[model samples]
Target: MSQALAHNIIAEADYLATEERASVRHELVGGEMHAMAGASERHNRIAGNIFFHLRAATRSKTCRAFMADMKLRLGQGALFYYPDAMLVCDPTDDHPHYKQAPCFIAEVLSPATAKIDVREKWSSYQTLPGLRYYLLVDAERLWAKCYSTNATGQWFEQELSAEDRLEIDCGDAHITLTLNDIYEDTGLLL
Candidate 1:
């Protein structure tokens, strides 16, 4: 079972309203709101590495990369989540509070959210038509899991070791994230 913060049931509207004023972030699951915990230094470093490389890669393009602040509306608003990192190439996905379409999503695995990120989110994110790559980044290791969608819209899992490179091809937008880039600044990268 996945652990949730606060462990309370809240309506979607109520959660949204409170989340704006709340200091910390929260994710809505099945109409229930769970407060998001602060990440470790290593986790933030890993996420920041990916975000920095992605931001630079898409700087001149129409796409934008966000680091854990943008909300993703999943299951047609049935679930609201904050992915660790995301890239949206479509202008329509530029919503104020939440985003509907994302070309790529990254989740840095932690003990508390790994199961939910890998299992629940895995199933939920596939529903988006624009999503092409979903990356599961390991904080304690150098490996990552890349799940890519095919032309038929079927998702396949690919393992990325330290020797592998990440090639993200979105609609007219592309970015290549290497393991060293994703783990930059960490001793592992050197």
Candidate 2:
């Protein structure tokens, strides 16, 4: 969530309509619209790296990967968020403007959104029945955290450094990502 546009509550339909024509992006949360801030170069690079890997990994499979421009609808449209990167495998979740269910989601943390991403989004995302993996990547450092659900529906956390490789199982396909792949061309590895 970003900064609230105003104290007034906006209807979901109205927010969607306004967002369609609005120059800037806004997320609807608890009936209030919050204006999203622009990302830094480093943030964009990190997010792009994640998206690139996810897209390639899911290309031959039924899954599709999306970047920040795609909105993820939650809480029956009461909460809408734009994740840095996400993977959706369910064919029924084909909304033109937003996604209702995602199997995997990644958020690259920045100074402004780190707290909300770690606390608010983390809490909300876990409530989704189809969500199996949630990744939090640090933009300023070579660190990542992954929360994955097991067969028993219990969630476990794993912390990764530059040398670690992350393996994700996406039903029919499995994808592996390394810090070198994520931080490539960002000058972070240098």
Clashing pairs in model 2, backbone N/Cα/C closer than 3 A: none
Which residue runs of candidate 2 sit more than 4 Å off their true CA positions? Answer: 1-6
Candidate 1, 63-101: lDDT as tens digits: 888889889988767799999999988987767999888
Residue by residue across 1-190, what tens digits does model 2's lDDT show? 7995657888889999999999999988899899999998999999999999998888778888999999999998889999999999998999999998899999999999999999999999998899999999888987789999998899999998767789988766577988888888877873
Best by TM-score: 2
Residue pairs with colliding backbones in model 1 are none
> Which candidate gets the maximum lDDT versus the true structure?
2
**TM-score for each prediction?**
0.91, 0.94
